[model samples]
Target: MTKKAYSKLLATATTTAIVASAFAPAASADSKDFSDVSTRYADAVSFLADKGAEGFPDGTFGTHLSIKRVDAAVLIAKVLELDTENAPASGFKDVPARAVGAVNALKEAEIAYGKNSSTFDPDSHVTRGEIALWIERAFQLEGSVEVPFEDVNNRYKDAISMMVANDITQGLTETEFGVSALAKRGDFAIFLHKAYQAMVEQSDFLLTVMHTNDTHGNIQDIAKRATAIEHVRSENPEALLLDAGDVFSGTLYFNEFLGQADLEFMNYLGYDAMTFGNHEFDLGASADGHKALADFIKGAEFPFVSANVDFTKDSTFDGLQNFEVSEDPADGEIYNGIVKEVDGEKVGIFGLTTEETPFISSTGEVQFQDYIERATEMVDKFENQGINKIIALTHLGYDDSLQYDNDLELAKQVDGIDVIVGGHSHTTLDEPVLNEDGEEPTVLVQTGEYGKALGTLDVTFDENGVLTGYAGELIKVSDLEADPVVADMLKPYTEQIEAIKTQSIGKEAAVVLDGVRENVRTKETNLGNLITDGMLAKAKTINPDTVIALQNGGGIRESIDKGDITMGEILTVMPFGNSLGIMELTGAEIIEALEHSVSAAPTASGAFLQVSGLNFTYDSSKPAGERVQTVKVQDGSDLVDIDENASYFVATNTFTAKGGDNYDVFKKAYEDGRLSEPGYVDFEMFAEYLKGLEKIEPTVENRIVDLNAAE
Candidate 1:
């Protein structure tokens, strides 16, 4: 039989078996009556009946009935005892206005999230994998296990793994876990029973970890995550809400509010602890961004922790604590961790961040230490303080790169760290990754970026407060309802920022590209051409000698798509508040900069230069300084050989003028008074120039040529 047909047949047979078993003794004299009752639950009647769950009184269990999204939520809430007192106010638009209470209850308990906006599709069908995730969240298992399904990757793996580890419907069979299969009511009932039993077993220290990452200024998802965490809190008093960071910066809302709205929303959500992400410093290397961070800390109900950063030098943040050690009566002092009394047992928490923060972060004043070294030190400190259970809240990315190591390495290197709540790389761990470096297992997990998933690690410790085992799952935000208060708090900022972003700046006749992989620095995109072209246009008006303009590839942050482009979009593309400046250089100095550009071809190097009104060529096979052997000027007639004796006015941004991109040639230009004062031209003026053009198109016209072939 086909798989579909086989599944249907199995479902029917299972229901029949359950119904027959329920009435076998009493219906011995009435076999026909027993057969009549067997049609509803099919394979699931026994399990549902055993758990005191009854179907509609029509003598039918409705095993084949497709489970509505709302029903699935209600089932989880009912089974986990998620109710009104624990759930926050509902903000979802589609959730039945009256059913808001039930939805809020489930949200507060950390059982359901709306995904985006305050709109839950209550009528949607519930998938088998989804139900498993809910069950895992409700039960709170610990330890990282591989996901059973082959199709599940970093995205939904965390949820699937959690469900599998908790004994929730084992992915269709013992070996094959299909993440997309529809959940039959009978199967769902069985999973719920198993989860309920597990919860009952752990009635002592009911620990709930409600976590969200890569929030990116998405206030609506924050509300949903908060509601779900609250739902977990209702079941257990010792619940804690944690964020893996990158909460502020990214979207228009973040740029507009400058992290204020995010702070307010996070405050409303009641986050317990959070770490820093690279994007947190997008504003610039200034005290204003730090002030914003300080403001957030002041408003936060929980602590902001980062072990690698030495904030002692920054006097503005003197009040912020570097590390927190909480002691449990049974576990003693827990360093780099938080100890909470959950069901009377002590739970510990710690925090870490990526070592590449120094390179990626725009906050130049901030510094980062070695992640593994700092983590080891913190672990030693905490262990010395007598803390047995430890969890690391890490912002390190999931995959290891040459610049920085992933969290798996950290878990292996650190002996005492038990669990790691990870972010930065946006990896979704369905099951915890096993630490290859140590004997003890280190649970590593990350909810996907943009608050799309919630990660819950349900851990159980022995009587001595030493961690014994754990289970974890990632809950998708798409299935639950959003909380209203958080949404309301963000409404004004969202509307304002969106309006600003949508305001049209110009029209495009064709697609304007930006960066290309492998040659992002050397490549000439339509957007790059437009930006350099604008700089040239703006500079020639000031200095008639301006024969060419050069813009660093790194300075061109975004591409302008072919459509109604806007001033706001331009601002987003070039959010760094840099201004245009003019510099004078000889042909030899220009060649030096061009040589630097090709030195790092096929890899990202800040020194890659995009030029306007000049054509040059370089050979990657040649040495750095000798690569650019030919330089010519585009004089509207043909390529004329550059005049080494004559001075050329080069227009560039303030960043490039400061010898950025290894263009030390500009340093001589600056010292010679050739570097003019900052001009009126900025990204905004460029956008207006595009708007005036009505329709501008950019093409690669061999601006750079290789002289090696000519020779």
Candidate 2:
């Protein structure tokens, strides 16, 4: 028979068996006429009589009597409505022809086995432990819960545990599982009854998770997000709302109010949990190191999960964090992990910040541990506590080039994580990505950056906590109506931000400055030239030896219209709060860094460089590491070829100087104390440079030339 047809039959028979055991024996029923049956066994005897079950032909259910293996097989086969007439041969010499088909059918279904290679042992009484294993296998029961029965051996522990978890049986006593005791007919009836009921009620468990990441303090559409969340919760009230961090930087909201404005709306919307993104620690280098972060945490309405981040060394977070998973999590506290019960199922959630945070952001004394090791520990802890459903709320980028970390690597290396809510790369996944290389599948999802969209994932799991099916999508927040309360609360913040948007910086662009993502990341643009020139000029002021400047194309966020530039436009272009740094590197090291800049040429890479005070040419046809043709540095009045062993001072953003975007050469210099950060924020420097410019005219001057491009 087909599996689907058989499953349908089993479900039907399971419900029938449980129904037969629930009701007391009816006085007028002809099936209740068995003389040897007591009230406890009467219902089962009546059910057997109506179904014409085997071993009850003498009008006696034989209450307290042990059932033979063959008779037990016949009863189960009849209840499951298996085709006994067409069953295959048992291949046993001692089996009776009348019961051979029933025993063979049970064997074919993998619910029963022979005592020896050739012996059916049809006459042997079935043991309670044996029955438990058979029932568990027949129905495909799963899960384990602590049980009081101590007599169950290791061999039968899994089956017994599954039975107890399903409420199918409780054993003979509080301390004894009766593994070796004979299965009495009266007791088997109740066991079968509960198993039947459990089977009848079994269906795939459905869970809905709504998530956001890299919001970057863009709360302009938070009201719409609230409406979207309400709509999703209207369908599934138990749906969890999660954030993957980076809500502390970018945009005017962060600069003015720190993270408190975002936190207010987050609390109002009822965020279940949050994890730290690299940008959340942006203020760690300030005089009030991590004080803003601490206040953000203290004002939050939900608990925070951070398995790999250690805030113990930073007194700003003292007494606010616990180092273990919390079963009863409190608001405004941090934990290594948290257990949340949704619709009677326990879901374990833990957080992982990028290990690169120390170099990329101002983490100060807040140490970060290895992601893989900490993730494994969290998984083990949750599993030990009987939690099978797990989620890793992470700021590790999705499919990031960092092999040591990333959502893809985490899913492949970790064993039990079922879902990953990811951020940090600003990836927009239209549908959830699945990594099935491990023992079980993991669903990785992220919404695009800047609060433009809300992501939703609807997943289904079997009784074993195995992901069976899923459907996910990104909902455009702009399409949704703003929630009235959230809209009202946003008025004060928007008014303040509006005032900041209109104030001019007393400079007009002579022409449209090209900072388009496609233009800036692929090749040099006028805006890139202007920005790098500004960096070079500012660095020279700090250290006269700073002769070369480089800016990552990713930092140029928006374009400038050919008109009076406002503070808002400049902040929009360079919103990451990255500061300036001067790095002392050998000429050979400068050449090596330039080679990496064009490695993904023809394809846009965020690591691509826009330079000033120096010019370079590369052949894109050559292999990535061998692409550079020549590099020259400004030497007084002339451009000269760089000497491999000579040292040169190069100006770049602190992010690049500290090895952001996989710049190993620059990172080495930063680590060796060859880098000095004067701490001038990028936008502030750009504003100053624009004011000093004669006429705001900027042009591409072939500073970065790719040889393979057609003339």
**Top candidate (lDDT):** 2
- Residue pairs in collision within model 2: none
Name the best candidate (by TM-score): 2
TM-score of each: 0.50, 0.57
lDDT of 1 by residue, 299-414 (tens): 66666667776565666567565455654311111124565545545555666767666554555566678888888877776667665667788787665342465777787777
For candidate 1, what's the RMSD?
A: 18.6
lDDT of model 1 at position 56: 49
Please list the C-alpha lDDT of all candidates, in the order they appear. 0.63, 0.83
Residue 463 CA error for candidate 1 (Å)?
3.4
Per-residue lDDT over 254-293 for candidate 2, one digit per residue giving the tens place of the 0 to 100 score: 8889989999999998899999998899888898989999
lDDT for model 1 comes to 0.63
